[model samples]
Target: MVSVASPVRQSESRGSIEPILAVTAPDMKRVNDLILAMAGSNVALIPEIAEHLIASGGKRLRPMLTIASAIACGYTGEAHVKLAASVEFMHTATLLHDDVVDESDLRRGSKTARTIWGNQASVLVGDFLLGQAFKMMVEVGSLTALAILSSASAVIAEGEVWQLSAAKRMTTSEADYLAVIDAKTAALFAAAAEVGPVVAGSPEPVRAAMRDYGRSLGLAFQLVDDALDYGGSAADLGKNTGDDFREGKLTLPVILAYQAGNDEERAFWQGAMEGGRNDDAALLRATALMRRHGTLEATIERARHYGEKAREAAASLPRSPSREALLSVVDFCIDRVS
Candidate 1:
């Protein structure tokens, strides 16, 4: 990792992403404009569903990371705008596909495109976004950036497929769970952050530092989310709470709770997770058990550890406004649990 002059206090954001917003707001508007233009298609339904998902209220953190990373590395060109938009397209495409696969009813506090438009349309539109994303990448004219984002797309797809079989399987270990999330969630983040430095023609050390920061932040973000399934609200999560529990997904808290439990506790988990005891009562019991085993708190602690790693990675970057904003994002992500 590259070394930095000093560490920024993690409390600067006070549970907000305002630092990132400040640095990327103008460029973010451009990214959004390009997204609107690119989302247009004569197919009608393609744009309809794509816009439906894109207009929802995500912070667009991944693309912002791309923009911020580039700017932090002393990049002063318009290429980062296209790359940031491309990163968002990749993320939005994944959410569409994930909703279909999970058979989910809600996303970002709105009806999922699949729920409103049916699964076939949702999948096809997701493909359209991928095509559009690649078009933007090609326009950027950096094969290295193109390769990173494209490979992340493929890895995310593989992770989705891998999760289908792994979901609710009692044999899924903590290591297996990490591998899944790292591919599905962190790969794109790494690419998003790395692309910024790559476009700036920054040194490889700086590029790698950005990737590490993004990867750690992604892991921390997802861990907080997984913990929220049992401990947080639907308003914050943008989906029904306990959604993971109902789907019989073996997230980190579930895995840890099951592993640390005794025979009876393990049996309870097997029945709830694999034996289809995932009704309301089962969800309550599962939550209780997680609390009893301290895994819920444990999961949040895990997120904090990763959050610190993210901060450390951000610290390695050269001092810049973007670097400080990235550090604040690390704080914002970890603060979700608090």
Candidate 2:
């Protein structure tokens, strides 16, 4: 269990985890330089903004997944580096847009792009990243890579729309929430894991296994994220806890709490759902209600379930150091507090 000890200091952010494959230190440096080169820019107006956000130091999880999956699949080509960079570009684009949509001021304990710059700049730079990602993909020159990324982008957009529309609507079910998360969060993860083998022409069964692995891991990751927003500290979470409550977003814990609460508890949450940041008291009460009704435990249990499935999905990949690393990463995902 994570100790509820002192106030959570920002440890080295999770995104800084070393790459799973046992690349020599020098080889890993080359990959890092390649990511920088791919993320760098020629555009005069927007390049700085892109660089600022790109350099914000995400763990590069998606790109790492692509690279790890490729290595596990016995890929020998240099294209994986470019493709992994493309994945990171796509993910960064989504974060820029998500911050704007959520009106979030902080990311990784720093001012978000929308807060540091403006929504307009953030959105426009996000577009630049999208364009850059496609350009990088073109350099890869494979129809399969294009297809994987293009479809994942479409699904992510659709998922965001679904969540935006569904927010605060009492009729939204667990299925509805799952659908939104699957689209917005899981699709890219699935693409990130699958693209490696697809690019390398791995056998069909192996490709499917990798896709399943990514899908399960993505679901687990988001579930843990949702849980942290309710139960985690601001220091640990890098933002205020209860943003979802203030914004009226009904994530899994709240959904389960809502379902489990009595009429009075339900009325309390309904009132809080429409309120804003000042409803910190209500958020704490709602969290208590979740604890009372066992929703927090349920959410954690579900995250663990998905993590197990993700590990299972990884089992069919051909044995390799990369495969073991991927499994260890799966173990780490459910362990995260924020």
Candidate 3:
């Protein structure tokens, strides 16, 4: 197996999300309760499938972002809780849909909802959660928040479709890959953070700062994940290593390796990405190429670039524990590969 270690390290506690969790604890409790309540349905299968994924050990970082942004902006209202829950529902809905699209078998170290409940059921339950999310958004009664999230939902769908089209295409550029991730992954994060300021009635500059922070953080988070697929353990990944390779997904590591490769190496990557070489040996060779070309490290460096951007954006926010926690999350995301 290919194992590459990250050069960056911090104190174990410094890299933990304990601060974010601590800052958002009370709000998160409400968010969790609302999630359980909203996920319930007359159709028992709906709750079963939804809860299967909802309770599947996700850190709920998106929702936490919503809560933290609001608190950091000095909002003292209950709407943030509703908005936080709504963010989580949107995230869960996307997870269900993504697993179906990716044909993924595992999520967060457990059987995917589709694996347990089947694709049709998973899709329908995802639809149900999305519906519930809109309902909560409506209850919160912020047109700005509603618009931000609704627009993000549409952007996310577009990103997924764009990624599907880009899949297995060897010519996919970094810009093209970045466009897909900006929509699929970062859009919701941007919306999740922006909605906090909207609910708090913070000024537009503050809103923009939080949104930028989230966007940069999301980009960094995904790059780290892509790097980890090649260099980290399955236990660290919460799924099998090289799942992206097996699925022929075009991520930054693969893109960089392909660009840096010699003709023989290019042929190897082309065959691998075209779905003709998905065996264990191919995965080893894929990682071997990535390591040899320093693509994994390059990818992590790219992530750190975005992590720095996220920190810069967070720096504009008011000084508070919540803000510091948000900054620490950037560190946590980039340092995970170590």
Q: lDDT of all predictions, in order shown?
A: 0.86, 0.77, 0.90
**Whole-model lDDT for model 2 versus the true structure?**
0.77
Say what the RMSD of model 3 is: 1.4
Which has the better lDDT: candidate 2, or candidate 3? 3
Number of the predicted model whose TM-score against the real structure is largest:
3
Give the higher-TM-score candidate: 1 or 3. Answer: 3
Backbone clashes, each candidate: 0, 1, 0
Error of 3 at 83 (Å): 0.8
Q: All candidates' TM-scores?
A: 0.95, 0.90, 0.97
Worst 10 residues of 2 by lDDT: 1-10
Give the per-residue lDDT of model 1 (tens digit) for 1-338: 10110121234446568888999999999999999999999998998998899888988999999999989988889999999999999999899889988889989789999989999999889889999999999999999999899999999989888888898898898989988998889889889999999999998888888889888888888888888888777776789888898888889989999998889989989998898788988888887887777787777777888888888988998788888999988877777655
- Clashes, model 3: 0
How large is the C-alpha RMSD of every model relative to the true structure? 5.2, 4.1, 1.4
- Which of the two candidates, 1 or 2, achieves a greater lDDT against the reference? 1
Which wins on lDDT, candidate 1 or candidate 3? Answer: 3
Ranked by TM-score, top first: 3, 1, 2
